[model samples]
Target: MNTIGSWQNHAISLGLPPNTPVKKQIDEFIRRWDNFR
Candidate 1:
């Protein structure tokens, strides 16, 4: 998948809205990256 597609997946998996702002998405991902790590 493309980068945007992957970003959407990440947001969805985190229970975030697909339309979430990019900065919020990044913060959420960073906060929960241990799930992947």
Candidate 2:
């Protein structure tokens, strides 16, 4: 998704790898937040 890509880009700008576990955690967090909303 474009939003996911944009988030990954932001993470990369902060020096994290796109495929890192931190990225996966953030993705999961967003998914849960969206579901809760």
Highest TM-score: give the candidate number: 1
Which residue pairs collide in model 1, if any? none
Model 1 per-residue lDDT at 26: 80
lDDT of 2 by residue, 1-37 (tens): 2455666665665456765566575776687679999
Model 2 clash pairs? none
Instruction: Report the Cα lDDT for candidate 2.
Output: 0.64
- Summed backbone clashes in each candidate are 0, 0
> What lDDT, from 0 to 1, does candidate 1 have?
0.74
CA shift at 4, candidate 1, in angstroms?
5.9
Indicate the worst ten consecutive residues by lDDT in candidate 2.
Answer: 1-10
